[model samples]
Target: MTSAGSTGWNVVQLADIPATPWRNGGGVTRELAMWPDAGDWAWRMSVADVDKSGPFSKFDGIDRWFTVLEGAGVQLDVAGVLHRVTAGDAPLFFDGAADTGCELIDGKTRDFNLMVRRGSQPSKMVRVEGRHSETLNAMKTIAVYAHHSPARVLFDEEVLQLAHATLAWRMVTGSAAVGIAAQGALWMEIPA
Candidate 1:
């Protein structure tokens, strides 16, 4: 991850982030960003490359947003309810405290995840295609991730070119307009 000058912005390239193997030996995760940058972070973002089906780690009192990024997709069982999620499909929001398990549809899959502790702050994540433009909220943190393709972001008089699987996050205070041009991506709004 690299800082974007002194704008309170950080740019994360998935290829540059190292992966950490899972204890279950089913997957490896690359953490994209985390608040506090230390112990007991309030929120964290990551991408997981799953090679097999397995149970997910339970994070009590946390809310989660999940999306399939690549591969054949997955069959997820969340609290006894089965949900089939594929790439380009709508995102799934579930309680992180639930007994959740992921079963790959075919062989391998990559997924994006956002976890935030309960009561810390509310967050919103959504899939973005085509062009998206919105006014920023001064009280909230904002991030735009380019998934599988290159994307462009316009803020003030600046333009940020985001490569595939890249995330551009702004953590500083203040509000400004942001215009994102992405083929397929994720837009996140969280606590600053």
Candidate 2:
């Protein structure tokens, strides 16, 4: 894990992280990052491969955002409300404590997830396509996940080459614009 006080940024390859099976035995997930690095976490980011249809893990007092990255996607039944989440769809946000279960739309699907502890850490995910630049002001941390290979990210004077499914993290304060070049990516901003 990279410290928040690190000099610049940390780039992580998806393949480098070990996969852990979901408690419900419905899928496998690779946790990308977590705050505090130990004990209870305020926020967590991960990617999961949903191979079966079943109930999702329950997390009381947590808000979750799910985005389909590959395959057809999944149909989420959140407290009786159904949501069709596909690769191109905006991330679906729901209560982690809700009675939630999912059905694979076509087959196995890969999805990205962001879980934030309610009231303590409010987070947002934005989809980025092609070339884009954004200024970070009110964020304590910013993470960029490249859905398309060979993604180029420019922060300050540093350049990072991210492979498909790879991610980069930066802890920021004040204001600065980050440049991204990719076919598709997910930008997650965590409030300080």
Candidate 3:
């Protein structure tokens, strides 16, 4: 876990996260963050590499959001309904307990994922390209992920730089305007 300080915000380097093989042996996943750290989590963020077609792990009571970050993409069969998703596309949200399977559309792919326990406040993830900014809406925590391109995040008077494929996160209160400079990035807001 890479970090800038013990403050409310810090950067997480992708290279610092060890990759673990998926339960189904399809590929590996690098967990970025998990709430409560040592016990059952209310939310989690991760990046996964999909190299083969297989069924996704079922989380029973979790809500999942996914976005492709690299390579081509994958076709997801959620409860028998097929959906094709590609890099740079908006995130896809689904029930973690659903019967879901994946098929490689074109070779290997990298994806970003957020999982929130059921009954928790809803969260949002959006793909950002070039220079952009947004106001956090009563979110208790926020994460900004730089995908292929480097990014700079400005919150209040603090400025944080994120190298390619890395991410920065902070526990927030109330609302704030966040300035972002990136060629490509993903912003996620989790409610308190």
Write down the TM-score of every candidate. 0.93, 0.91, 0.94
In order, the Cα lDDT scores of the candidates are 0.87, 0.84, 0.87
* Per-residue alpha-carbon lDDT of candidate 3 for residues 1-192, written as tens digits (9 for 90 to 100): 856575577678889999999877899999988886738898899999998999999999889999899889999999999989999578999999999999999899999999988775788888888777877667578889998799999887778888898888888877788999888999888777
Candidate 2 lDDT score at position 110: 91
Worst 10 residues of 3 by lDDT: 2-11
Q: Please name the candidate that would achieve the greatest TM-score relative to the true structure.
A: 3
Candidate 2 residue lDDT tens string, 106-155: 99999999988888657888778788787777658888899755688887
RMSD of 1: 1.6
User: Global CA lDDT of candidate 2, please?
Assistant: 0.84
Candidate 1 matches the true fold with a TM-score of 0.93
Q: Which stretches of candidate 3 lie above 4 Å from their native place? A: 4-7, 137-139
Flag regions of model 1 displaced more than 4 Å. none
